[model samples]
Target chain A: MQRIAVIDYGMGNLRSVSKAIECVADNAEVLVTSDAKLISTADRIVCPGQGAAADCMAALNDANLINTVQELIGTRPFLGICMGLQVLLTHSEENDGIDCMNVVPGQVKRFASPLLDTSGQRLKVPHMGWSPVAHSVAHPLWDNIADKARFYFAHSYYCAPDDQGSVVGQCEYGIEFAVAIAGQQLFACQFHPEKSAKDGLQLLRNFVAWNGKS
Target chain B: MGLAKRIIPCLDVDAGRVVKGVKFLDIRDAGDPVSVARGYNTAGADEITFLDITASSDNRDTMYHVVEQVASEVFIPLTVGGGIRAVSDVRRLLNAGADKVSINTAAVHNPELVQEASDKVGSQCIVVAIDSKCVSSPGEEPRWEIFTHGGRKPTGIDTIEWAVKMAEFGAGELLLTSMDRDGTKIGFDIGVTKAVSDAVEIPVIASGGVGELQHLVDGVNQGGADAVLAASIFHFGEYSIGEAKAFMQQQGIEVRL
Candidate 1:
């Protein structure tokens, strides 16, 4: 059984993500932990975050989990969600802008579109709800995840990775935004796969199964 | 892009557990809110709306505790209503981990409360909860009227008008429930939703009528709701959040998928 360590840095949504992982990988040992040792020893990792982007990074820094995460990427299976994904960027526009994990070479910015609808309104800020995610090619992380899965989203800022190829899934809310990305064994999604239901569970299963094979 | 439809799961949380019934009566199928929220969150829920079903004001502590508990547990953005009346209440909930607070009875009595709460918190943090009943009276076209105090007292304010006014006062979101459709599992009040969504610039969540995935799709496509909040179907495990999102995507609406 693949050991999936759900990195918990006193952040939000640890339990649901664990439950989702459990639903998919019943044999997999899904444990939520902030300890660097457990993260280092785990076969794979799932990082879920809520609240401000900077706060999430701060939590990691406070807990000293950043180095462990850095060491795992490209070697061990790793997934980041929402703030978890945002913190992987160079920096975000959230909360006076804190430096990110620097794992991905990019800056997360706010929506710049101003085009309005027939009612003279463009998309609102904090693009909430389920938006469509499009991708050019399949990423291994998306394994059982469908081509156009309507994953849950609640975000105000978006990651603008310097390397465009990293983005594997895209969602359009008045404007297109990166929904999912893959950089070697490191997979991240702005949408909440833990809360995304069967497709989400399937994605978790794929990560575990992929980890097992890898 | 057209207005996106949202599939929301309603949670009537009490002591950290989810309690549901028809028209707010005959409660059955009580489940843990944390577990149920996990179910909806994984199922592709657009957003989760939690209503404190506990009637006693004394449960404020427990309600606050539950809100903090769920917020700590779930990562998705959530809206919390019920048992919230003052700016302090709003402050406590937001501080405790809720992204938005829904106001109903308080706003009905003191329309200024909307502005007050919005001023203290950002307009984006306040949501106006309107429980409306369809009234077809002589010399008046058929329209939904706002009700307050757990849907018992009629405020006589037009539902659409109330939504618009609340927005003007800094209430950024509207959680509009149709008293006639709630708990019936029929569907949402598309007409009311369209009227309110057309009337306000802020996002409007269509609640009350949600029987199945089709209802959620209709609420977004035809109804013009930014999101759809339902309790029975998803809470009871009848329809999963992923099925509802896929259903919405199939209808040509943009969803996370």
Candidate 2:
């Protein structure tokens, strides 16, 4: 059976993510751990997190899992969710500008304050609840999920990749932003598929069966 | 196309079973919280809120188990509220698979608890639940005061001002319930709901009334709520979540169908 490691670096609760993966991938062994040894041996790696970007970086550094994450993203199939996707960028504007992993060339940006939608109504920060994500590029992860599927999102900041071509999916809150990004074997999204219902489960199933190819 | 306005069905769980009451009294059993949650999930609810009305401390553990069971099977966001007194309580619920924790009485007692809990477990998971009642007289400008202990006692705090303070205290969202209309089924108190929703930058969920489908629409269009939450209308099978969303959609409100 294939093994999947969900890296847990003292971040927020990962039970939902691990549980969702287990529910979808019955043939795979899903391990939620921060141990580099077990993580390195896994066939696929999933990085999921919540909270501040600076705190996430600090926890990753203190756990000494930064290098392990960097190496795994290079060779194996890797999925990043929310803060997991933010920390992959070069830097973030949150917590007074914190440096990130630089695994992907991008800058994480906060939603503009006093953000107004097309109707001139003020949009709330954190961008909580479900929003439709429009796919910008086709990939294995979008296998059964329809384009522009509504996914659960809860964040105040978003990633803007330097290379626009790397953007796989986009969603509109105040301004259209990159909600999903890809580079070789790496796929990351700002939305939490684990909490996104049926369409979300389909995406997880696709990831489990993915061969790390575009 | 844009962020869909959320329709949340609240399950008031008491001693491990789902119950509904008219204005916090005259309680009636609905069903199992887990099954009710699953039915709502299948009906296309955007999110689920579990208000633990369990009075005794001994039964609190039952709320946690209910959350664990629902979160395991239901993929949507689950929020647990009631008797959350400290940051530790918030942590325990999140660890139990709840995506968010709503703090009401404790937050009113100590506003700093909001800041501390939001600091410890990112603001995204900290929701400040405000139970307010209109205290203004006829022909007088509408004024609201915060209430505690299931709307039994009144604290002279202004609802709008308190909402602003909670947002400043790092609360990610505000769950505003109008005590006057909570179980009356007349609909949300749009005046206070709009006031609080417009006063803060964080998302506000308008809760407590909601007799019919139009009430849900009005909560978004008129009250400026980011989400609308109702209990009896859903728990009693008055309207399915899909029917509400479809009605809202027909009224030109953006909703996930």
Of the candidates shown, which would achieve the greatest DockQ relative to the real structure? 2
TM-score of chain B of each: 0.90, 0.95
Tens-digit lDDT track for model 1 on B65-139? 776666655656678888777888887887676767898888888889898877555555678888998887757
Model 1: CA > 4 A from native = A113-121, A212-214, B1-4, B7-50, B56-81, B84-148, B151-173, B178-202, B208-223, B230-257
lDDT values, one for every candidate: 0.74, 0.90
DockQ of each: 0.14, 0.78
Q: lDDT value for candidate 2? A: 0.90
Task: Look at candidate 1 and tell me the lDDT of residue A181.
Answer: 78
Model 2: which docking level applies? medium
iRMS, candidate 1, in Å: value is: 5.6
CA displacement after TM-score superposition, residue B60 of candidate 1 (Å): 8.0
Candidate No. with top lDDT: 2
TM-score of chain A of each: 0.92, 0.98
Interface RMSD of each: 5.6, 0.9
